[model samples]
Structure formats: C-alpha cells, structure tokens
Target: MKNRNIDFSMVLALTVHDMKNSLGMLLNSLDELRMENENTFDDSSKFNTLQYEAERIHNDLVQLLGIYRLGENNLSAHVEEHFVPDFLSEHLARHTPLLKGLDIECSIVAEDINGFFDADLLTGVLNNTINNAIRYTKTRIRLTANEQDGYLVIGVEDDGEGYPEHMQHSGTLSFKSLDFNTGSTSLGLLFVSAVADLHCEGERTGHIKLHNGGPLGGGVFELWLP
Candidate 1:
C-alpha cells in the first residue's frame, strides 16, 4: 500500500513568503529605475505599470506578514490617539500617483476624528480596503469618519461595482473568509479583523464590517472602534 501525505497549508505559507520577498526586490529595482531614469519613458504607461506592480507587491507583503503573525498568535498591536486629517493625508499622499494614473478621485470627509488605535495596524487595514476600492471603483473613492453608539466609525467607500452577494455573505461570517484565490480578501481583511479585535480598552473591542450601500453606493468598509 502506498500513502501520500501533504501539509498543503505549510506549503502555501512558504510559497507566499518567498513571493513576498521577490516582490519587494522587484519594487526596489523599479524604484531605482524610476529615479535614475526620470525621462526614460515617453508615455505614462510604463510609470503606471510600475506603480501598479509596486502596489501589488505592497499588498502581497502586507498579507503575507499578517498571516505569518496570526499563526504565531503574536500579532502585537499598539493603539494610540491619532488625528484624522494627518492619517488621511499621509495615506492619500502615498497613493497619489496610483490615483492619478487610474483617474480616480480621492477625498476625505470629516471635520474631526481622533481615535486611539494601532497606527500600523489601522494603516494596513485601511490601505488594503482603499486599494481594493481603487481597483474596482468607477471614478471616485472616499475615506470618511464618524462617531456612533460610543464607537468611532471609519469607512472607505467607492463608486464601483458593489460587492456581489456571496462576498457580502463571506464578510458577514468573517473577513478572513474573503476567498484568497480572488486576491481581494487575502491577508488584508484578516489582518483588519485581528486589528479590530485587538482594539480593546477595558471591555470595548473594535470590529470591521463590509456593506453594499453608502454615499458611494458600491462598497463601504467600516472599522468600528469601541
């Protein structure tokens, strides 16, 4: 009798790790080329391609790192009070090129939004959601914040194809179930879920939810901090 044994989960994890490293190197090389050869391309296509690839790499790395941390139950989080304007400005500044290349309009809607949360964790969570919106959006994306029911609510909305029914259902069960094969769910949502759960001070815990309708009328990703 012949028996076959395979630890598919371990293999998949290793493969993702290797790809993350490779993607990082590729991004670095592209950055060097962009800097050393500013006038290299006559058209914007090459630059746009580079921007998109870099974003892809960045997204992948975020997912891989998050998954690795989850396996160890050592995904540490630091929550602190941060200004909404500063947070939104920094995120938008980093994606300016990608937004311009895709002709997508980005905006922030809020007067004041101060919250205590892990900067890096929230950044990764919001970045992934916003990046997803950028890809599926028609022409606009927005980051908005509010306070409701003793929780701080931050949302990323897009004017694009609204989430299909199945995906919405997956989101309901858990963000991690967001179908990795599609790449939209990947590690980002899982990481967001972890981060949200980590935002506890006393008996309050933050959480994330996906919705189909909002001002954007497409996808609305909300992170609730309690």
Candidate 2:
C-alpha cells in the first residue's frame, strides 16, 4: 500500500477558528457581569440580554466547529445511553440565567424516557433549537421527549407565530433562503442537519424535521433517533 498525503481543507478550516475563542471570552465577561450585579437591574432582564447574546455567540461557534469537522470528515457520532430528563435539566441549568433574562420560561418533560446518543453534538443541536425557540416565542417553550415506534422523539416547541406552511415542507432552511441579507445565517440549521445525519449506524439513523403545529401551536423542531 502507498502512503497518501493529507488534504489541505483541514488547514483552511482553521481560518474560521476565531469565532469560538472570541465567543468564549465574551461569555466569561458576561459571567462576571452576572455575578457583579446579581441584583443590579429591576429583574434578571439585563443578565438575560447578556445571556441571549452569549448564547447566540455560542451557537455560531458550534456551527463553525461543525463546519471544521465536516471539512476534515472527522464528525463521527458517539452514542451512549442516557436519561433524557437529566440531560435536559443539565442543559437548562446552564442556560437558566439567560432564559430568565429573556422573559422566556422553559419547561422540559421527559419522564420515563431514556436513550443512547452523542451527548456533545446533541447538546449543540438542542441549544440551537432552543435558541431559535427563544427568539420567536412569546413567553414559553417546552422540551418534550417520548418513545415512539422504537425511536426516541425529542421536540422543541414554542408559542409564537408559527412557520409558514410551505416552509415546513421544503426540507431546507427556508428562513435563511427567504431572508439572505439578514443576520440570520443558516449556520444553526446546517449544524442541526449535520448532527442528525451523523447519527447513523448500518441501516438505522437519526433524523430531524420541522413542524408548525403542536401543543404550543407554533414552531416545533423534532428529532427522531433509532
């Protein structure tokens, strides 16, 4: 067998590596602000704004990382069994300060549900979904998990103006397509799709879909993993 040279795209991926480092610094600064003025504002609203922006930065970083992984073909799924409720609670705790700040209440209901999954990638995907829910939701968002047909279905639902009917069926990032000039890049959607696709083994794989009708009667993001 002959030895082959490594590809150059891996080196190019490093060019976009600044986002994570800068965002991390920004999050650290926001943490300091939260501690210094735990009661400075009327409510946690100020910290909420800080948290929302920080979360945005974080989601962008996640997308950047995913892109790098894809370029290197190193984005592999690492699934392990875990309790859904505990996982949801842990992520919520990490973002609680920001949620309370943004005036969005999050409720997670994952009773009697457990599954195997790639924790780190799933965390990033859920964070993006929750961030979008927070952006469009009027007041509340719910995370629900249940087992169906030998698959674990996790949903992020919001209470706000739902997506257009046509957008849901397009199977593309309709929001980004419609508003290309806006700041809402399709990075998060791309990250979600990549993570979902990575969760494949033999004939079974995880998949995700977008819907507009659910208990919340707004946008619903569902991920199904077998």
What would the per-residue lDDT of candidate 2 be over residues 2-52, giving only the tens digit for each residue? Answer: 767766665555654666677778877876777677676327665576678
**Each model's lDDT:** 0.75, 0.77
Model 1, stretches more than 4 Å misplaced? 1-43, 169-185
The window of 10 residues in a row where model 1 has the poorest summed lDDT is 169-178
Each model's backbone clash number: 2, 1
Top candidate (TM-score): 2
Candidate 1 residue lDDT tens string, 31-85: 5665566555324676867767677667767767776777767687777789977
Q: Largest lDDT belongs to which candidate? A: 2
Model 2 residue 66 distance off true place after TM-score fit, in angstroms: 0.4
